[model samples]
Target chain A: MPHITIESGKLTDEQKRTLVERLTAVSSEVMKIPPEFYSITIHEIDDASYGIGGKCIDLVKQEYMEKHS
Target chain B: MPHITIESGKLTDEQKRTLVERLTAVSSEVMKIPPEFYSITIHEIDDASYGIGGKCIDLVKQEYMEKHS
Candidate 1:
């Protein structure tokens, strides 16, 4: 069985369900396993708790938005 | 930010804490990032929900134990 876990910013329940379904579909198709045999979980995280290049994602997003918009 | 998600059988709170700490330590060391900037999430799964090679992991583990023990 394949277990998929996604950790990211907050997601709505509907989004979580959709993500799980899509991930399960793709994984089952690629791994040749039954969809029911898959397990998927989502962990909602605060943007402050995640960082890249020593900068928080929240700050990165803010900077990107400022530059683009 | 780098988010680490681990999917496995049930684990105690201590186990989860230790896992998160260890994962963060190694990840920080390898990626040259601060440990505090890392996010770790664990998804505890039921054996029935996970399968491989068309067989549930629970069944596989049971068989292996039986054979070896």
Candidate 2:
């Protein structure tokens, strides 16, 4: 069985909602399973908990600086 | 059968290396399966390619701001 779980940092309710919809749609298209059958879970990990290459998430931070800083 | 894939934002070579090791180790610990049996895949979705809900990953960006700013 292919069960998909998406764990991301914090997202607005709207974002989470859209993600669920898109994931279901994509899964259905790719795997031929009904949206209802697919399970998508989102975990909003605090920035500190997420790290890349033993360091904190620097790249994600850089992008944020460019766009929103 | 359970095959685990950890799709993350772009990671440094070191991060990817550690992720593979950690995922394998974690899977073995939590699921009680050997690392070899588990499959961990990482995808570096460009900033634009990954969106949360209808918007791009704004929350992730915000976290990055506080930490790296």
Candidate 3:
């Protein structure tokens, strides 16, 4: 019984469902548990709410996109 | 930029705050990152919504509590 939680930027409902399905499948395979035995929760966060490398995700994304694009 | 996501049974606001603070402190110590660079998200889940060992958390808790008490 694995409880998987993912926190990241917002995603569509379809994306959320797909993620849950994929995570469940992979976790079940890796852990030798049935997919139905797994619990997955997705938390949609704002870019400003998440931080990385001492900067908020929004800033990081902006910089990265600027550099890459 | 470590994004920490915690999924478990419901916790109080105070508990959530304490958890975030403690996790940030320890993660910063171990990861050599500033506390402000860490992102922590806590998801309060109902026992029924979580599963382990093919059993829902509510059932697991009830059985465990009964056995222990």
Q: What ordering of candidates by DockQ runs from best to worst?
A: 3, 1, 2
- Candidate with better lDDT, 1 vs 3: 3
Once superposed on the true structure, which residue ranges of model 2 sit more than 4 Å away at CA?
Answer: A58-69, B1-69
lDDT of 1 by residue, B1-69 (tens): 557666666767866666566656654554456878777666777988877788888899899999999
> Which of the predicted structures, 1 or 2, would earn the higher DockQ when compared with the native?
1
Q: Taking the tens digit of each residue's C-alpha lDDT, what string does model 2 give over A41-69?
A: 66666666667556555566777799996
| Model 2 lDDT at residue A4 | 48
TM-score of model number 3: 0.51
Going through the candidates in order, what fraction of the true interface contacts does each contain? 0.24, 0.00, 0.21
Q: After superposition, how far is residue B29 of candidate 3 from its true place, in Å?
A: 7.3
Q: How does model 1 score on DockQ?
A: 0.14
Better of 1 and 2 by TM-score: 1
Candidate 2 has an lDDT of: 0.55
- Residue A56 miss distance in model 2 (angstroms): 1.4
The Cα local distance difference test for each model comes to 0.68, 0.55, 0.75
Question: Which digits, one per residue and each the tens of the lDDT, describe model 1 over residues A1-69?
Answer: 456665666766766666566556644554455889767666677888876788888899899999999
lDDT by residue for model 2 (B1-69), tens: 124444444567776666456545643554444656555566666656666556555566777899998
After the best TM-score superposition of candidate 2, give how far the Cα of residue B9 lies from its true spot, in angstroms. Answer: 25
